[model samples]
Target: MKDLYARHRAVLPDWLALYYDEPIELTHGEGRHVWDAAGRRYLDFFGGILTTMTAHALPDVTKAVAEQAGRIIHSSTLYLNRPMVDLAERIAALSGIPDARVFFTTSGTEANDTALLLATAHRRSNQILAMRNSYHGRSFTTVGITGNQSWSPTSLSPLQTLYVHGGVRSRGPYAALDDAEFTAACVADLRDMLGQSRGGVAALIAEPVQGVGGFTSPPDGLYAAFREVLAEHGILWIADEVQTGWGRTGDHFWGWQAHAAAGPPDLLTFAKGIGNGMSIGGVVGRAEIMNSLDANSISTFGGSPVTMAAGLANLSYLLEHDLQGNARRVGGLLIERLRAICAQLPVVREVRGRGLMIGIELVRPGTDEAYPQAAAAVLEAAREGGLLIGKGGGHSTSVLRVAPPLSLTVAEAEEGAAILERALRSV
Candidate 1:
């Protein structure tokens, strides 16, 4: 493992961060458990950043991929692709947008990039609105819109970007406000920013539950309030559901459903979970906005047959098993358990998040100041106790993220929670 780690550092970009001081090379996985190079099994809570929606090495998805691979795999968009069209149709129907259309990409970054292009072209504007402490993706265009300074590497961007004030309600100017008051304040801020724009703004893109921003979320209906204002200015709303999509949030099938008064966003971006670890990402939007691009564009590897098959199979399993309910029940118990445990731990500043997408914010024992070291220490300790978790937040990265597979069993949840409790106590 040490030799492999040294080789990884030698070849990979230094910016591509790896977790842990002694990184473990995951060999294989089954259900909610993954085995490392040393054949040590550990509970997988992060789900490869929530990409494995159903479970690891799901039989249905694996069989679909194998069958698809045997039949055919690589076909460009020029030819008629049944699996791609089939998956797109399903997504369009599932998406609430009127006259919805679907376009596939290989990753969240590309999906967001395409959404930006569509928004800019449709609205005939280069200006965009994003939320502070939010992370969209790592592409040059996505990095530009990302409000998280830690993930954003450069100031240069093709479009004019404006940061908004709603994404985080726990640690912002509006933190103290009640839910209704917070919504009003954020809406006022959005309108104020719109007034200050030089030209027309194309769209306002946001993550429903700010994923890399420690699963932080604004009050429900906040986006709906902003939607009302954006509609007045003819600005489109884009919901970045890369992490919060497909019932992972438990309460809502799509994160935007929490703010359903506005019907739905003009555009929605999704990735990570739908394919259950297959590389599949896409934008679902109204036909008018999606068809705004006069010129042709295509993703060479997007919506490949194998990936689409995996997505179809995985999505079927997710829906058939009603993993959303599982997430809701299991996650509720897990969060409550952690909250009960953390009540005695002063280093835990807050336990926040919905469904399986939970975050534990670490702080100094006496101060509200973020204690990233404590988070790191807890993470290491969790691994030592045979559980794998993840961490992310603002610049400080002080939140411990726990988003296990949506199909997590109650027993597994209890086991993982006990381990996490021990780890936290140790830290």
Candidate 2:
């Protein structure tokens, strides 16, 4: 383990953060459990940052990937790939956008990059609006639009990005307001931001639930209200579903559906779950917007047959098993359990999230000061107790992120919760 860690530090970039004081080397996984190289088994609550949508090593996805690989693996976007076409067709239908067209990518960053491309080119504007305390992706262009200063390295970007309000509902300046008034205040703020833009704003890109900034979300219908204002300005609304997509939110298939009154966003970006550990990401948007690029473009590994097959199978499994319903039912119980436990803990500030995507904000015992130390301690304790979780949030990484696979069982949930309870107490 020491040798591996030394080698990793020597070979990899320093910014690529690894969890734990002693980073783990995971070997294999089955269902909701994974074993490290040392042969220690753990209940995987993070699911590789929630990429493993279904269970680990799900036979259906495994078979699909293996079969596709045996037949063919790399047929770039230049060819007519059946798996890609089939998956695209399915996604287009599922995507609420009318006359939708799907463009495949290999990561959430690339998908969001494509969405920005389409939006900027279609609107003939390079101005963008993003929510404060939100995270998009790690890329030259994506970092610019990212509202989280910790994630974004540089302010120099191709597009002019204006940070707006309404991402975090509980801790921001408008936190004290009620739902309706909060929504109105954010809409007014958005309108004011647009009015200050030098030219027409291309689009407003937002995450239904801010993931890396913690599982923080605004009041329901806030985006719908914002959408109404954006529409009046001929600005597009782009829903960044990288972390919140694939029924993780429990209450809705897509997090954007919570604000369905304004209709679907003009464009939607998805990743992290559809591939079930395979690399798959995409953007679904109206045909008119998608076709705005005058020049030709293609991604060499985008929509590869193996990944597409994995995605198709995974998506099928999710729908067939009614994982959304499971998320709603099981997640409700998990949240209730966590909330009940957290109410008695002074270090815990809040337990916020929907369904499987839950976050526990840590604060100083008797004060509201963000307590990153407690979060770190709890994370280490959880691992020691054979439970693996994740950490996020903008408050110096003071939020514990708990998101397991969609197929997580009731017993597994209870086990995880118990382990987490002990970990929190130990902290």
Candidate 3:
């Protein structure tokens, strides 16, 4: 293991960070559990950062991928692809955007890149609005719109990016405001930004629940409120659902449903969980905006037969079994249990997030300051107690994230919560 770690360090880029003080090489997984290279088992609460939506090694998805692989795999966009068409049709129907059209990509970065292209081309402007503490992706175009300074490596960008208020509900200047006032303040801020803009803003892209920003979220109607203003100015609203899509939130199939009052966004970008780790990402938008590109564009591996088959199977299983309902029941119990435990832990600041996407922010005892070291200590202790979770936040990376697969059993939720409780106590 030491030699393998040394080799990984030597070969991999330093920016690609691995978790834990002693990183474990995951060998195999089943359902909600995984075994490390040394054969130690753990309840997988993070699900590879919430990519495995249904479960690890799900039989349906596995069979689908294997069957497709046996037949054929690669087919570029120039050719006719049956599986891609089927999946695209399904996504378009699911997508709330009017006259929606789906375009496939292999990663969230490319998906957001496509959305930027559609928005800029449709609106004929390069100005963009993004929420504070929000993360889109790491690509050159996506990074420019990302609000998180930690994730964004460069300031040079083609677009004139404008930072907006309201992704973090519990911190910042609007933290003390009530939900109604907070929504109003953010909308007013947006109105003011639009009034001062030099060019027509192409779009306002946001995460319904900021994923890499530690699962932070605003009140339900914040975007609905923003939508009212954006529509008046012909600015498009894009929901980056890479982390918040596919019924993970339990209450809604898409995170945008929380703000359904104003109708769906003009564009919705999805990745992460849909392919169940098969590398599928795409954008769903109105046909007019999606077809705005005059020149041809194609993703070489975007909708490979194998990945599309996996995605179709995974999505079908999720809906047929009502994993969204499972998320609600099990996630509710888990959050209640964690909140009770956190109430007693002084170092734990707040427990937040909807359904399976949960976050526990650590802070200095009796103070509001972020306690990053406490978060690190808890992460190490959690691993020792035979559980795996993730950590992230816009402020100091002080939040512990717990987003298990949608099919997580109540028993598994209880077990993971118990282990996390012990880890926190030790911290």
Candidate 4:
């Protein structure tokens, strides 16, 4: 393996150094555990950054992908494919948007990029309003909407901003405003920005619960208010559900449902768990916005039969088993346990999130020392204790993210939380 890494390093470009590669070579996974090349098993609490809604090597998804591969594989967008249409209809029905249309992509980034483009085209605007600390995707346009400055880098030319503000959180300065006040301020800011741009604001994009932005759930009524403001301004609301969709949040099939918003977004993007770890993503939007794009706005690999089959199977299994309820139950248990743990640790500032998507924000008790290093140590200690977790947020600060597969059992949840507790103690 060392020799293999050396050989690959010799061929790989230096630009790949941006990634933090783990030392282990993973072979396979099942349920909630993954085995490294040396055959050591680790409990997967991170769930591929919330992508594996079902689980790794899900039997149903695997069989579907296999069966689809044996049959037809690729079909041009010029012709309708059965799996693609079926998946689209399923998504539309599940989302309670009968008039919704689906546009497939190979990854979350592409789906978000498509959503942004469709919003701009349909609304005929050049400005966008995004929540600070929100993460849309890595594409140029999506990155512009993303609020994390580190992702843009110093050398990269900054995308011209429409507007951005911090998400609803207690730690930020924006926390002073109550939920309604914050929403109103956000709306007023957007209105001002749009007026400044002469009605050139295309959309207001946000995550139902900011995922990579530290799992920050918005204050109550915020999303609903934002939706109303967007409607007033004729701006599209784009929900970037790349990390929070596919029933991971537990209360509903999509994260936005947690907010109890009255109307659906003008556009919504989903990836990650849509195909149960397969490289499949999609943009679902109102028919008007979806149809605004030209006929050539599709990739050769997008909506391929294999990916469609995997998506269908994943969604089918989720619905048939009612895995969303399981996620809610198991995740509730984990959150309760986490809150109890946080109460005991001075470094832990707060615990926030819903369902399987959880975050533990760490702050120094007395001094200004942020505990990002402590968080990394906790993750390393968790790994040693047979659990795998991940971190997120700006500065890669301490936000211990727990996003296990929806199929996780109560026993697994207990074990993972125990590992986390032990990791916290060690740190």
**lDDT tens readout by residue for model 1, 1-427:** 9999999999999988899989999999999999999999999999999998899999999999999999998997778899999999989988888899999999999999999999999999999999999999989999999999999999999989999999988897888989999888888888889899998999999999999999999988888888999999999999999999999888999999999998899999999999999999999999999988999787789989899999999999998999999889999988998899899999999999999999999999988899999999999999999999999999889999999999999999999999999999998
| Candidate 3 Cα deviation (angstroms), residue 230 | 0.2
The residue-by-residue lDDT of candidate 2 on 1-427, one tens digit each, is 9999999999999998999999999999999999998999999999999899899999999999999999999989998999999999999999889999999999999999999999999999999999999888888889999998889889899989899999999887899999999999999999888888897999999999999998999999999999899999899999999999989898998999999999999999999999999999999999999989999899899999999999999999999999988988888899899999899999999999999999999999988788888899999999999999999888479999999998888999999999999999988
* Clashing residue pair totals per candidate (backbone < 3 A): 0, 0, 0, 1
For 318-384, candidate 3 gives per-residue lDDT tens digits of 9999999999888999999999999989999899988999999998999999888988999999999
lDDT for model 4, please: 0.80
TM-score of each: 0.99, 0.99, 0.99, 0.93
TM-score of 4: 0.93
* CA RMSD of each candidate after superposition: 0.7, 0.7, 0.8, 2.2
Of models 2 and 3, which has the larger lDDT? 2
TM-score-better candidate, 3 vs 4: 3
lDDT of each: 0.93, 0.93, 0.93, 0.80
Off by over 4 Å in 1: none
Model 2 TM: 0.99
